[model samples]
Target: MSERVDLWNNGNLVQDIFLGEIKVPVKVLRNDSFQAWYLLQPRENGNKSSKTDDLGSLRLNICYTEDCVLPSEYYTSLRNLLLKSSDVQPISASAAYILSEVCRDKYDAVLPLVRLLLHHQKLVPFVAAVAELDLKDTQEANTIFRGNSLATRCVDEMMKIVGKHYLKVTLKPVIDEICESPKPCEIDPIKLKEGDNVEINMENLRYYVDKVFREIVRSSISCPTLMCDVFYSLRHLAAKRFPNDPHVQYSAVSSFVFLRFFAVAVVSPHTFHLRPHHPDAQTSRTLTLISKAIQTLGSWGSLNKTKLSSFKETFMCEFFKTFQEDTFTESVKKFLDDVSSTESKEPSGVSEPVHLKEGEMYKRAQGRTRIGKKNFKKRWFCLTSREFTYHKQQDKEPIFTIPIKNILAVEKLDESSFNKKNMFQVLHGEKPLYIQANNCVEASEWIEALCRVTRCNQKRLSFYHPSAFLNGNWLCCKATAESTEGCARCTADVPADTQIEIDGDRETERIYSLFTINRSKLQKLEEACGSIAVYQGPRKEPDDYSNFTIEDSVATFHTLQQIIDIVEKLNESHEKYQKKRSSSAKYGSEENPIVGKVS
Candidate 1:
């Protein structure tokens, strides 16, 4: 595959001409990952190798994983084990934990695992379980989920899978505007060009930040229900994790949603497909400033820790000073609360859900744990904020009561599930409570009523089975498993919230990766220096490192050490992640599993 780039100065109105391309063999990347900087060789038609220096080198982090997955029948043992994760406490000992342990990176394992769990509607419980375990180890609430552990990665990937449309509705337009109407936001005097105005740049930076932050805070309704549910779980978990710290509730949600997700996407819009191409350098600087400000405000715990003194650059410090207004912080807190809110809201044009909604319906209970002959029975049903109950007759003792919180999803039941019309399913923790309304309108009303009351339920499902489980298999997909996920997605009032799929890439982390990729180049340079000193002749193999020098060697090395010691703490992190990566015992045996499974 080849990547091509062209540089034309649209702003300068100067005749610009620069083209570069690079290609690699298919064999090198087959069923594996390729990550490193490649020389941005000048366009040489179809040439694979060309020694060219005019165009700068580009860092390419690409992975191509092709798995020869056998048919579903062949993986029954493994699939069955994995689907039973909810039943496993601590979640660290479960099959899902082992699945991540075997992967080279959690990123690779998270997607398929989340997709599988979400498919089975088993993701919420596992998430809550793992997060609870993660909380136990969190000595400081601010540092919760700071590491790119499996639980965090699972939620991150889940958002990416479902929140793409969320990102579109929430931040894409603002991102598009910023990318198109380029602005010069470089305020540092050393880096500024002759005509650059620091004051104007600062104003533009503030404007962009205000716009983006405004859009985000106003987009509570657009947040996805799955994300909200996950956030709801996180907020409660964080509060319980640090009972004394009320701010942990806000921090836990914002740490991922804003600091990690939204800010990262704003900084690199191209990666999330919000923009067609990478922004110009000036525009990128504008975005980077905005992202920094947003992250600072989002850091509710860090607010107490750093007090906004985290900025090292004097200009950035000055820039953040402009946000001394309390509105920014309030806005951030409100947005986090809204995103993580589990308090059910009445859907528009629907008000009776809060007070009461009582009707007659046919009821049948279905679940994996059931062990009895079942039949549909006509019953009078009533729903309220506290509980959903059904009695043998109206105004009489209730036969059964389903706590409102227990309700996970209220979706249209597939006719194929029971061969009866006007039927719907109410899925909860214990079993599927099948209800049949009098007619289609009545069914719709009941379903809507149940959903409105349980809309903010922390464990509400993103999807559910449309068809009923019959005999030993699901009629919808013909899967033999009783605990299989629904074949259809559930309807929701919340729009998709956000999709900021950012890997943990701090400034030092990026520098460290670049240094690692080019460590061989540095070694080669040392050899070239040694050879020339001994041979006393002209350089034979010219090194390509001469062209890129944004900093001196001593300063660069000093920055690198800081990358390890200060910013990334690379040495300690590497040891933790690489510990027995090849051994399953590193995570622990299935009989004795470890929490926070590392890669």
Candidate 2:
């Protein structure tokens, strides 16, 4: 029961008009799959007497067949079969391989397969095996792991799922800064604004590329250990496959990390939650220039100077020439070495500070016991990944230090509170620190920076008074009590840490369902395996197992027989379970809710 709204003006939700919604019972998803046009209805508890206009229906396709997973014992047979995938000789014949072959799309099969194997700590061997097979099919050393094979998709999915936090802590601050305080970095001659100098724009683009690149390389320690392990496997397997090429291993890791991970993040920062929304036209051009430069720099090892010629625009080629130094190449190599290491990639507990925002601003002192105009003093303010601090002067210290974790909320101050034009407040456990920026843009920039960094803080507020607490009361809400809850709800409360937990049993069950749907194709695959095993003459031009890759026929046939047996047994168990469910839940109730086309 939620409404989607437009995110604009520093992640603030504005013009949030009410829309229709659909309410489906939780139990309706228990062991049932449905596709229906659920009619839209008015908000149930919203103002009852209000005459709401009619909203249209919505087509929903639900895949939640199991609301809760069965106990561990129920999944034992399926679990054992998946765990022994590597041991099954000629990995192409294994259940995992069969799933990849029969499914129309590789991703549908790869998701469940990767989760199951990774969950049991048996992923590397299978990935290496598939990658080796993929390499044998390739003649050129340059094109390894470029195709969307099972091995490639598995690693791609793994990086995205595991590296959620890595992307956030590494790039979010820079992305926020770029979006908030935008400068003209558009270098194209046709696209330049009136005062946009080509050299200045190029320098700005380079500065951003350097900042993002530095953060990425130095933050390898934050890379998830699982990602490092998978990358290590890809690196070794690729080097083993192409023993002549000295740089194949770097390409193997960079193919996914830089080309897929960092480059894509830079191009579309909002998708990664680095930006609150898509950047304006000029900002987007800046990001595109930066992203293109990064992609080339990251590809330093494999392609060498060859990829520089791949740039389209004449200025782009010129702009990219700045990164030809050996230092940039070395940085890419070092980053690859760090990320693909087999050792523990854990953080050292001491957080390094990456600067987010800074400027001189007027701060009204938190005179909790007293209030006066003399407390307002100009101070040098600074923000970083760890803490926010301000000093008496640009070079002087001995002022204030507020940990970012304790920042409760930051909002604009009531203009009437201090008769100031560009004022805002930093709310924490103590009294609010009211500050006045030089202008509106700087004010919004500071607010956006603080809010983005502390978004994941557990103690962050859901609401805040948009005005100042002055003269013993909140000016905006006119609330006399200091602790009274805020009248205005807070915006920009997106969760800090993304949770992408994969249930092992549920994934195993999903694999089972995929197998059940393509059972006939599975039968054909088995027959093809048998034919390839027994036939010893001139093979047919269009062979039986041509659709599926059969590396070793006898081995594949043996594995397929075991798979068919397990699926049949599971099928019987499912039938018995279905009978029990239908008998017990004939009448729809809370235990087995029924959902259908609504009035």
Candidate 3:
């Protein structure tokens, strides 16, 4: 006889099938309330053969309905299992799918989980999984994943693990999205009145411009495409508004400096030197943007030459004055030359390279050189008239020194197999010492300066080689040698006029003196107008204010004003009390003549 087997869920019989078909797949009811599973068998009977002998059985490991509510403990256990087995391929995929679902609607809840994944360097897989899921909350999940701090950390970690190229492809879109969000550029209207309104506005503009450029720089380190977008945005803004407003002019000009600084920093972090080797494509792109920006500024300046000339001069002078002591002075000078009008000539007099006697320092700059075959390191180079010495950082004694007299020739090397473009080889009796500069211009400057100090002809330096200026078939004159009847570019054969001796050192000193005088007057004005706060404390004040001190100057002024108001109020109250006391004494005397007589 045929017998039936039944499966019960929470005391409700959900499924019935023939007992003989126990090996076949059984379909059970799908419901949240279904908790337990049971199997029934035919009761033992005295027949020829019974289809099933067992009377009852229990089934474990049954899957509940998809809508069934899971306990917190069950979820925790599942998550733990998933995390523990994350290294396994199938388990990892499953975990990612489940975690994505869990975090789909509740991002805040799963932040801890996300942090845990980031901590363990497992975020990429999870992010990849979430990216693949076609869920309604995918965009939200992506946003949560690319939240600023988290996204930065994730990108940093991915860069370390998967490298910059990989992260560039994977995370660049996210960075672009983050950078596309606009920041508030409002300035404090109150501060605008306390100082020169133009200066105040310029400062605010500079701060915002710096903020935007810094973000662009950070983003461009990996994905260079964003730089074009940032450049285009700035150029657009500057072009549209620069002609109408000085504030826009100031922003455009300041942004040009900012871009130049960033470009130099990217190519040469040690001294911000813009050498030929600094990723040509990127550097060229940045420099092109800067040139365009500067051209825009120059055009505006030219249009409003009479009105804006003072501002331009002051801006350039102040910028140079601020960074005069830094190695970037030369770079800034080059930028000024590029952007400034022809009428505004930089101090053109060539300064005699300072010659040192004994311990006197002629010049000092940061340089890098190879000590051995492959051990290249950066060092502090100090030049004296007698010798050029290099030292390790913070060392009292020099690691190496080359006598000025021993130097035969200083020649710039071409881009070679081992040496870079900004390298100069000093021939000191056949023991060639190769030194590198931050950029081609710096290298040329060093060579020229060294030539002058060593009593060598500066024009004879390798950089001044005629071939250096050749552009393929054309000379520096822009005429093709084949097309021209004769080499008219050969000016060396022509007798030149006598060289005019202009004291560049004296002119530079004069410029600096003027700058110092103007700076002092400005400082005095700032102090007088309460733009700069003066502390009359017991201790002596510092000549240069600390960053914190400068930031607190305005607040300190406001606080002093508050204190003065409070003191005046207290003084008025004290005067009133004194008047009341005197009146009371008079009244007491009038009331009692005996009391007055005792007094």
Weakest lDDT window of 10 consecutive positions for candidate 3: 490-499
The alpha-carbon lDDT assigned to residue 289 of candidate 1 equals: 79
Model 3 CA deviation exceeding 4 Å by range: 1-80, 84-93, 99-105, 134-203, 215-599
lDDT of 3 at 74: 26
lDDT (Cα, tens digit) per residue for candidate 1, span 1-599 = 64454433444532223346567656566436777677776554343433577567777767753432223443443455567776764465464664454344566556666776766667777888878877776898768888887778888877777677767777899988887777777777778889888899878777888888888877665566677888988899888878898888988898889877888888878778787655656677678778988888777744432465766887777777777776777777777766777665433223354555998888885454333335777889998766899999999999888888788887777776667889888787767898888998888777665654565776767677777777777778888887777677776433212323332222123323433444454444334434434555555675553432212343333322332232233444455544544353544665235667388
TM-score for predicted model 2 compared with the true structure: 0.64
Which residue pairs come into collision in candidate 1?
A: 166-496, 223-497, 224-497, 417-468, 464-486, 465-486
Candidate 2, 1-599: lDDT as tens digits = 33322222332332224345566665455445866666666555433422434666677666754423456677797789788877777778787988899888888899989888877667878887788778888887667777888888888887777677889999999988888787778888877768779898888888898998888877765566556767888899888888999988998888889888898898889777776555665677678788887787887463346766877787888787777787778878877876786432222222457677888999988855345668789999998766788999886883998887788888777788877789988888887888999998898778777765665454667688887776778878888898888888665332224335568988888888888878888889888877766786885487766678888878877777887788788787777776676679855765455677447
Ten contiguous residues with the weakest lDDT in model 2: 6-15
**lDDT by residue (tens digit), candidate 3, 254-311:** 3333333333243232222222122222223233333332332323223232434454
What TM-score fits each model? 0.56, 0.64, 0.19
- Find the number of clashing residue pairs for candidate 1: 6
Residue 302, model 3: Cα distance from true site in angstroms: 29
Better of 2 and 3 by TM-score: 2
